[model samples]
Target chain A: MAEYEQHDHDHIEHDHMTIPKYIGIFLVLVVGTILTYFAATVDLDFIFPGANTLVALLIAFTKMTCVMLFFMHVYWSPRMIWLSAVASFFWLAIMFSYTMQDYLTRDPGVFSP
Target chain B: MSSHSETGKFHYHEPGLQHQFEDMGQQEESVSIGMWMFLVQEIMFFGGLFTAYLVFRSKYPMAFAAGSNHLDAFWGGLNTLVLIVSSLTMALTVYYAQKSNRNMQVIMILLTMAFGATFLGVKTIEYRDKFNHGLVPVQGWNKRIKAETNAEHETKPCWEVDHNAPAIEHPNPRGEFQWTDCSLVKKAQDEGYLTNAEKIGYFSNGEIDANKFRDKVRIFYYLYFVMTGLHALHMIVGLALMTWLLIVAWRGSFSEDYYMPVEMSGLYWHFVDIVWIFLFPLLYLLGRHFMHGG
Candidate 1:
């Protein structure tokens, strides 16, 4: 078999991210942080017990989306890369939820004692 | 160095190949997969603490809310912004490295390290303030210092006036009455929560009275220290990695095809920033809800 030679393409056909896209992601992250802080200050007791947690999780998910899509270059990469990351998250959710079921159901005072 | 134009396919099986890998792509894939696995483990590590926080808060909602109010949101917000900026710089560093721009890569990495350091510095200031104000959890954990000070000053007795003088005098210039050191411990000793032998040992060793000062609230401080300390350690490790990368980058060791190390390190740095994004709100902002009466 012949050795494969590296080819130099002056015009690389890969999709490149623009500076504006990066700036847009950064702006969204900033807005998300501010909104999270604002949400924390709100009196949402009437809404639910963990309203703040829910709002925070939503903001965190948004931020994660921005980071994964833009900073990690996942959007520019092959479909396989994106699939792997999503798979990892899926596994993580399974692990977290399974353990949390047992944890949430335990005697509340067990640890305190 | 062989030019890519001279070869049809990039020769990645050079001397840098680790013993475990058959080829470059496979090695790269395995390394990335392994890193992802480690990151998953890290998630679980932090997840356990988060679950604990949730359980305790649910059990003692009032105490947790009260604890939350004491956290200053301004610092948390500023730190979030700082970490985001660091993430941007880190991403830029990877971008520049991919383009084989050595100077830009070095500059971006340095900027990222600077931001990480700034974050740790701010965190140090916040932790120190908490320590000095006795806001740390132990046993007899002092409540919010500002609120307590206001309350104490509002009811302080006038020293120069007669007993019949007005009950509420001018705000005490000295502010809240400082609790006498170890007095609570002495009270605890009198109450039999602590044996006389333990009291003697505490007094002799200058150990704080456990019974009087037993603020289980200290548990919060313990969590604060563990989480923030672990985060800070990650930042430190990132800074060190960047510093090493800076030296190599300055020496012009990387090119378009061989910038994988820098790219991988950037991924790690960005992950750290992501952790801080979650931590800032959970640790600092969550408590701000108490400021408005429920």
Candidate 2:
């Protein structure tokens, strides 16, 4: 039991995120924000309709991932904790998918005429 | 070291360890799981709003685009940056707490609180702008003007891009929500992507109706207010959490053995930031391409 306690301490110490790493992720997030802002200014509809929205969402998703992993320290968390985090997102995706499926497949003709 | 209670059973006494938990590791894991569960529910709470936005936006793309175009991206972007920086400070506070560096912990907490306040300050400016422009959806909730006789209070054309069209008075006599631009409807007419909802929603006698279009735009502004208002409320709660953290850190109450409070609070702060990360683009950036004629 004493050895088990020491092992747990050493395991957590190994997982500690460095201060520099935190700052690095911060810089990445700031750059991602600026990039998304400028990306919105340029007309990307030439690529495809709603292309601009897609690009902006992609950038935002990237920034969110950085925050969740580094700033929130989920990267250093144990397996169960990380699984729960991912599971939350999975559940969110399920909600979005089901809701969107209903809306996207609806016949607008029913609402009008 | 293990001690004995009166009954002679083993009692492991780690600092900050609850009696229910077998060890510090177990205690930390349990608390973290609990916090994550709370955040999961929070995501769903906000997720419902996002679903509403998606449905309406898809139904009336032009209206959503026009309404989104009016939002000041500069202010939204500034708030996004502010929240991101605050998350950094919050993460640093947790870092310093783990190192037993009380002074740095206090300083970082103060910095986090300052940034959180700055974000809320920016929200106040944005909300006030919405009120002044008669963009609030509720009746009698906007800035009311009694008369337009004053030279400085002359009514101006309500263009979608009027934020840059010089200072002009928006006279709202009955404090009703005001929106006059229907250019997106015209554009959609030309492009032929206007949905049947928009067909019935924005037209009267085969002609585009400004009032009908305005009502659709009103939906966009309504979601904008509710989402950002709730986000700002969360930031206020984060500030309160930081204030408590400041007092405890100043008292040097945390060390390597006990910094879970700081970590948990940091988790919450970053979660709030993540929400704004998605909100800024969805609200302010998505429809900007429409204005650029993309």
Candidate 3:
């Protein structure tokens, strides 16, 4: 194990996230949650239809980014790790878009007898 | 290398390091990548359900709105907060593990488990509330009240109340899924904005049928139960993970040189938190504005 220690001192990288940083992220997440909760109370369809859903989703996306980057440590991970992490979302997008394309493009009248 | 093998040790040996790996860094990398791949698959697993939700919600938005309107956002929001705090504790557990602070590691793991239990506890309360209100989608699964003493209260839909607010009860005779509010469907019909799916789904012979609308709302609750039930199942697994982590951490098994287990489990805990982050807004918050005179 001594050789392992040598490599650790020489090659291994540690992110060493500070307590304050974690606390900051936690506070940000809490605020985001609160914002999402209250945002649903206001009828923002006057501004634009589905504005509330868009805003909530936007906030959720932001919060998810923070968790994945900082909490999950993708921010400090290697390039390949970043690639794999991002690839999941990329594949998810494809799944969502392709499925939505099929559902959204169907002629409604075609189903009617 | 032969001599080292005879001595039951290798030149690159580290605690928990497998013989196949040349060094700890290689092992850590391989394990980390493996965990990420597993999580990616998990995302896709839940993604299918999400797509189903999107499709159905887009088709029968009024039914979704009415169903979502009844979910106590207060309980859902509180659970979100509980989960976030647990994630913080989990992250701290990883930090302490890397610091080789055994006591702190044990404490943090315990705290994480505590918060996880709190989340599950809150879910139990919400599920029980659903049972009392006959919100469980499956027939004969909810609390059954055969009497008609609840006739006056039948028409009254419960307002979404904040934390610690007393739960209002609804009576169901046959212990079936019940959705009394059809106001949103009526509004859509009156506004002439009903989608094609809704035009057929909610209407019976040119009139809005309450039972037909209830079926659509049942779809919403079905998705709700499946998604959140799977999430809760994950939390249960997470708690089981913490149990293992706690035992090892208490034995002082992890240290600065070998804390990969802690880190990997932290990834899992945080991933669950991320899922809840999305689930909260989608399941509880999205359709809320419809309740406010929309």
Candidate 4:
């Protein structure tokens, strides 16, 4: 058992993420949460119908970046993993934008006939 | 270490590579690719709901605004904070697991579970409050304004000359009126539409309104329940995964080399947390403009 453990230990690096990095990520998320709440309380309707949504999405995107880069270890991962992650988001955008274009631009009056 | 050397230019795969993989690097790449593919499908799942929200909000902008105002921001904000904190703990757990610190991994996993439970508990309180007030979207429970008046007559023996005296006209008998029992059945009852005792029983028994509310709120609560409830369910799953990981961590299953499971699970948990971050604002904060009458 000990020999197997030693053999396993030799291949893996023991030190990458440290306590400071963890604390830093935690602080960033905390700031994002606070900002989201603050933005929600403000009246941004004059800007657009979905201004709050945009703000919220921006914060969410920031939070996701933190998670993907830090928690998922994509920063240290090979290029292929990073590319796959980016590709997933690209496909998601295509799916969302295309479907929403059809729904948002349709005239309700067209169905009356 | 010299086994490869003694084999004389052997091109063996890395030990971590599964039997079917061409090499260790290929195996890692495949696993990462598979996870990304799964995440893409998750995006599509959430995308369908987002599209629905867009269509509905555009159709009934005012109604959607009115509906969004009903959600309490404090609870929503608190839940957001809780999930963010939990994500931090999950990341830390993976970090410790990678370091071969079994004790730290267990501690962080337990902390993450505690945060997850806190979020669900707060959500339960919010749901109960919505049900108590007739904010739950149901046929009769949607919105009902009831005007109740009570007259209390006290007769003193010396002050009353005639026992059969005409009842004094209390023009506006102001009694303690509350929004008590303002549900679908009570709304239907006040409307005087259904007189059948059986029908009244059906409505008044709380079953009909509850069902109506379920159906009506089904759209809102469907999204609400489906999204928040699904997020809560994910939290539960994360807790279970953490427990299993914790047990293994306790047994020293993860080391510097073998902590991929812990790392991958943490990534998933963090993604779930990020979903809630978006959900909080979309569901709870988008319509604050209508709160003060738009």
Best by lDDT: 3
| Candidate maximizing DockQ | 2
RMSD in angstroms, all models? 9.9, 3.2, 3.9, 12.1
- TM-score to true structure, per model: 0.73, 0.91, 0.91, 0.72
By DockQ, the better pick of 3 and 4 is 3
Candidate 4 chain A weakest lDDT stretch, 10 residues: A1-10
- List runs of model 1 lying over 4 Å from the truth: A6-15, A76-84, A87-95, A106-113, B1-24, B138-216, B292-294
Q: Once model 1 is optimally superposed onto the true structure by TM-score, how far is the C-alpha of residue A29 displaced, in angstroms?
A: 0.8
Ten contiguous residues with the weakest lDDT in model 1 chain B: B154-163
Better of 2 and 4 by lDDT: 2
Off by over 4 Å in 4: A1-15, A110-113, B1-27, B136-218
lDDT of 3: 0.86
Candidate 4, B1-294: lDDT as tens digits: 012322323444343445565444455556666776676677667767777776555443433444566678899999888988888888888888767788988899889889988998998898776655554544353324343355454343211223245533322222211121113333333544433322422333544433322232346555665677777887888888888887888887776545767777877787788788778878887767545342
User: If ranked by DockQ, best first, what sequence of candidates would result?
Assistant: 2, 3, 4, 1
| Tens-place lDDT digits, model 2, residues A1-113 | 34434524632442367888888999999999999999988888789888988998899889988998888878878888788888888888888889878877777566432
Candidate ordering by lDDT (highest first): 3, 2, 4, 1
For model 1, what share of native contacts is present?
0.35
lDDT of each: 0.65, 0.84, 0.86, 0.65
**Greater-TM-score candidate between 1 and 4:** 1
